[model samples]
Target: MSRELFYNSQSAYEKIHLQNALIFELSKVTIPSIREIMVGQLNFINKELAQKVAAKVGVQVTELEFPNQSLPADSNYQDLQSEEREAHTKLSAALSMDNTIKNTIKGRKIGFIIANGVNALHVQDLKTKLEGEDAVVEIIGPSMAQVTTNDGSMVTPKHSLTSIASVAFDALYIAAGEDSVKELLMANNKPHVLNFINEAYKHCKAIYFGEGSEPLYMNSNISLKKHIDPAIVSWEDETPDNKFIDAIAQHRVWYLELERNTQD
Candidate 1:
């Protein structure tokens, strides 16, 4: 319909047909119930429509008095012409939809930074839980070579630390094992691994440090922060896995970006 409306060569009959089709499609849209509509932050225009919809649905509307500061103090809707008023109503509906949040962690890309001597159990546990939630997990090693866990089991990494940056994934995890942490802290690998953590911290992405991984956390820029960031999960927390999962679902903790970057 939009294409037909903008077509320069469209005949008058075709334009009329497009208008009728658009009107028919608009008319078929179901009027949402008061509960659904109320989920959105309402403005004056939407509030008026909500009252009428509630009445039609046999729900009593409760009036909550609050100042509508979105508009100027001297602004008057009555001053607007018919076309301008219609445009304002459309804009209000679009903005309301923009503010809605969908809570889910499915399909999120999670990166695990590891090295030789990594705790296989630590790697498997959280990886299982996250994968169960339908998230994609990728193992990252200091180099392209295979990583040998503490138990002598070999694990292949999907990416090398220097090959990919923190921006490639939605979140990061450092598994437990003193030997693994030591391997990661080695002269050659330390800077590359720290760069991944620092970049992830700068972007406000969730970072989980398992037991024995504290040294890596302390060395990163995260340790310089003035305040605690909920998205930065440490091994000391009770049920750290649950906390990490919840943080990932919330997406980035953007509100604390400044505090996270500020040094004490």
Candidate 2:
């Protein structure tokens, strides 16, 4: 049988196109029942969406049927205190400083290694800045007795290098001045001084050096030239205080992992 009906071809095409567009726009709407059923399986909980949909449709999500899926708990699942707590604790521990010591270096022990003819200005600037941030800054020298600065001012060391190990301080700063660097290099034979620096480097502690302090590092370990990095910061480039402070706050550098791997 053959039958023909006259109709506007343009009208038919437009009607079909409009129907497809409407279907696409409608699918963009998130289905609340489906989301509620996949709460644990997806990145977000749909409790709020479920409530909104239930209100609009005048029905409970529990009325919906899920043939092969597990529905979310009836109770609210929006709170994530447990998950947030774990993440917070882990990050804090890794940084070695909790919220208490984040902005300020409060209670952290910072050692300034100096000797005869040490740069008085460098020592003063670093000590003042660190102490202003509430960190405990102590002067360490070869002797617990008095040492002279480049300006002929007598400064006493709070602790001797031999008495206190590098592990005792959170960070170390070597002052600038040729005389101090020369003396430190001469003392390289003393295993305690070299071991102190080496141990600090191995442990990934921040070490700051002034312009003339390179000799101390170079003489302590000949291989230092190969792996020196920002973990061993220097004022030679006139680096700003904030850069050093931010590095200290990070507690360790990504390069430390590289050094550790090489050692292993």
Candidate 3:
């Protein structure tokens, strides 16, 4: 179980729900005469809660201690006892995140919302920076047709505004250009574009509004909020690209979900 499931639970109701879920899953184990189970990293915050759930299922919980000594250099894996193999497997699972966690933004999917006459410089500059960090960037336009940038450069969109929802990407960037913003605000596409921004805002995902994109921002549900949201980067921010990248790396601002969704 993730420690966040316990420590980050907002209320008693959520805690109870988690406990019930744990009990249901535990009770489904069909092994007969199961008396005790060893759970690693069963520390202070989650240990007591876990024990209560286990007790409801009639099982005793024990802390799984890591082996202190290293195995012999010539030891054969096939000769190890089943119990030893199980212990090693559990240890690996417990420490997996330690090896997997890294300080990089690799593989994050960022969506750039644009229309014909989009700001070529803003689109290219941010895309270059994000791609340099190994993040996957996709251009989402009003349609799949080639979008003409302010510089008259043609850019192909990977997705249309109506085709993909905000949930499909890790973060969103509203590309800048007076004409592009105007095109996005047209009667036919305004609703879809606003829905994209509002949904991404509601979900606490990072959203960067480039220069000349204020009209869309003011028209979206984001304008309704009075609170300062770090994930919602605007052109007024200094170094907006860096701020957007940092926000994306942090994933979602889950702590502010309530405020973001509240009807003001």
Candidate 4:
């Protein structure tokens, strides 16, 4: 329908065509409960849009229904909402961030974990590429100092490894050395790092890891399998591929399926 009405047309017509699409979608949602939630979200995104769309779709504001007056326990409704989001994401790749790379890299930040002995050039090259794409990359050195690489280049530290936390960035790049790895294990802050990665995974954040950092991502019995998405894994970077990078740029595995008990 959009193709029939607005294909090969000017941008001015997109709003009009999209409005028509909204009405069609709204009509197909037979369940009034779904419509109520959708309309609120739609309105939040664009008020004039919500007003115009509901009117164009012939849905009166007064006609909206709130069937359930009492809220469910936090455990019940919250779990249901999570399941619904996963269902919506799985509905189509078009609805998933794992599928789309929005052009704007605004507020996108990259964290690089490195030590004195590692290859500084590799880290620099990766930074150059990411920066070219408008991503901010920071050098997280093991300690504050100039680290002489195999090629004898002075790689200065931006932030110390101990000072940096996973929450510090949207995505993480690990150029860790033997020392950093030892530190991670010796001080195995399992709960914290695990929580960070889990949160990042849940929030659709990106993670890029090299051979040295692979241990950090070694799946520790946590099931990343729930989503059936390979994009969620901690990755090896020296052998870079299009799909993983694309997935990183897109930023999340929006396609998901939650395992849940059947409703009675």
Clash tally, candidates in order:
0, 0, 0, 0
The model with the greater TM-score, 1 or 3, is 3
Superposed by TM-score, candidate 1 places the C-alpha of residue 238 at a distance from the truth, in angstroms, of 0.7
Question: Using lDDT as the measure, what is the rank order of every candidate, best first?
Answer: 3, 1, 2, 4
Model 4 alpha-carbon drift over 4 Å, by segment: 1-107, 143-152, 161-164, 176-180, 188-199, 219-228, 232-241, 256-264
Candidate 3 overall Cα lDDT vs. reference? Answer: 0.77
Q: Write the per-residue lDDT of candidate 1 for residues 43-116, one digit (tens) a residue.
A: 22344434444443444454434323245667774454233232312222222222346377898999998888
CA lDDT of every candidate:
0.73, 0.61, 0.77, 0.54
- Encode model 2's per-residue lDDT on 1-264: one tens digit a residue: 101111111133322333334334434558755444433222122334334334443334452232223336673344422232222121122322222244546677878888889999878988898888778898988887798999999999998888889888887887788888777767443566677788777666778877687766775542453565666777755554555666666564544544444553
lDDT of 1 at 181: 96
Over the full model, what C-alpha lDDT does candidate 4 score relative to the true structure?
0.54
Q: Lowest-lDDT window of 10 residues in candidate 4?
A: 255-264
TM-score of candidate 3 to 2 decimals: 0.64
Q: By lDDT, who's the top model here?
A: 3
lDDT of 2 at 4: 11
Candidate 2 is scored at a TM of 0.57
* Local accuracy of candidate 4 as per-residue lDDT tens digits, 114-147: 6556656666777777777787888765567766
RMSD of 4: 13.8
Model 3 pairs in collision? none
Highest-TM-score candidate: 3
